[model samples]
Target: MNAQREKLRMMLTSAIFAAIIGILAQVTIPLPLVPITGQTLAVGLAATILGSKYGALSALLYMLLGAVGVPVFSGMSGGMGIIVGPTGGFIVSFIISAFVIGWYIEATKATVTHAFIANVIGMFINLFMGTAWLKVAASLSWPEAFAAGFLPFLIGGVIKALLSAWLGIEIRKRLASARLLPYSSSKRTA
Candidate 1:
């Protein structure tokens, strides 16, 4: 009975986080290659709070929602065309980032510093994948891809990383205090 309850809780939590990701995705600044979005912060928050499995699950749900022609992506866009587009890689990277962030935080007992490090690592993954996808999908050279996709987002990525770190830590602490945490694997000795 307890196991079934936990599973249901995880499903509901992931679904809620996925919806948050979609809502935040709508907050964007349309750029040339990858548009700036509040998505990364939301992803980090989900991962940090939900732990790895549920966090990744949340991102997967968001991807599925976007793939099914829902406008849950940046600038209110979605569909198979968007997924295969130059910016699709960035969208795809969200799952990986959320998972990595949650895994790292869980491993580190969900420390603030670890959360920040995880966010940085996830940002780099996004940059690399998004840049590569932009290169191939848009037929741009490596330098052009970096210039249009990666470089422009570096500063903003750092800002988001910091913001995500702070927000995640605060939320985790609050949830911990409220005894609403660790229906995930984040039942740490911290």
Candidate 2:
């Protein structure tokens, strides 16, 4: 009964965070190609806190919410149109980023430096996919695509990554102290 309750609690918490990610997407800085948004911070936080499966699930939920016309995506956009828009690659990258970062953190035993590295790598993945998609969708040249899509968000991405890593490390430390993250059993042996 206790375990079931805990599981339920975790699920609820995950769902709330996923919704938070969606809400954060509404707060954005308008730009060409890809707009800067708080969604990446939420993605990093979710991956760090919820582990690979749950983190990915949370991102998936966020995407689903937006696809259903929830106005949960950046600039208050939603529906299938947003999913196939010029910035759609970034949305797709969110799923991959969450999975990779979460898995890397899990594999590295949640070290602070490792978490930071994971997020940095995830950001690059986002950049690559986003820029590539923007190029094709917007009929932009390589330099133009990179300038419009990748360059503008570099600093913001760094800030988000740093903040997420710091927060994630702190959370991990607290959870470890509380015996919530049981190292012996939870350790990924890969």
Candidate 3:
């Protein structure tokens, strides 16, 4: 009974985090370049606290929701068109970024520095994928893509990484204390 309850709890946690990501996606700061959104920070938070697999699940669920025509994307947009659109790469990369961040956090000691490093790498991956797709989908030159998608967001990425790392570490501590995280569980059949 306890085992089943734990499993269900984890699933609910994943769903809650996915919903958080969806909600954060709507908090956009529109710009001429890539509009800033709270989505990445949410992704980082999920990954940092949940570790690789669950973190990826959260992000994947978010993308799936959007793909199925839910308005889970920035600016209250969604559907297949949004996924195939110019900035779709970044949206798609959230899964990869979360996975990478979670994997790193899981492998490491989960220190704040580790979270910061992992998140920084994830942000770079986002930038690369977003820029690459912007070039192809929009027929933009490399310079144009960089300017419009990557350059403008460099500072913001660093800020988000730092903030997410700090906040995620605190959240992880609280969740662990409440026996809500995977690592907080002492039993395993495997």
lDDT of the structure predicted as candidate 1: 0.85
- Candidate 3's residue-wise lDDT over 139-181, tens digit each? 8999999999998888989999998888988788777877877
| Regions more than 4 Å wrong, model 2 | 1-7, 175-190
- Give the count of colliding residue pairs in each prediction: 0, 0, 0
Q: Candidate 1: which pairs clash? A: none
lDDT of each: 0.85, 0.81, 0.85
TM for every model, in the order presented, reads: 0.94, 0.88, 0.93
lDDT of 2 by residue, 1-190 (tens): 9677656656776787789898888888887557889999999988877777767778888888888898889988889888888888888888889888888888786766777888888888888998898888888999999999898989999889888878977775776567565453145421
RMSD of 1: 1.4
Per-residue lDDT tens digits of candidate 1, residues 65-181?
999999999888889898899988988888898888888888787777788898999899888998999899999999899999999889989888888888888887878777666
Model 2, residue pairs in steric clash? none
Better of 2 and 3 by TM-score: 3
> Candidate 3 regions off by >4 Å?
1-3, 184-190
lDDT of 2 at 126: 86
In Å, residue 170's CA in model 3 sits off its true spot by: 0.6
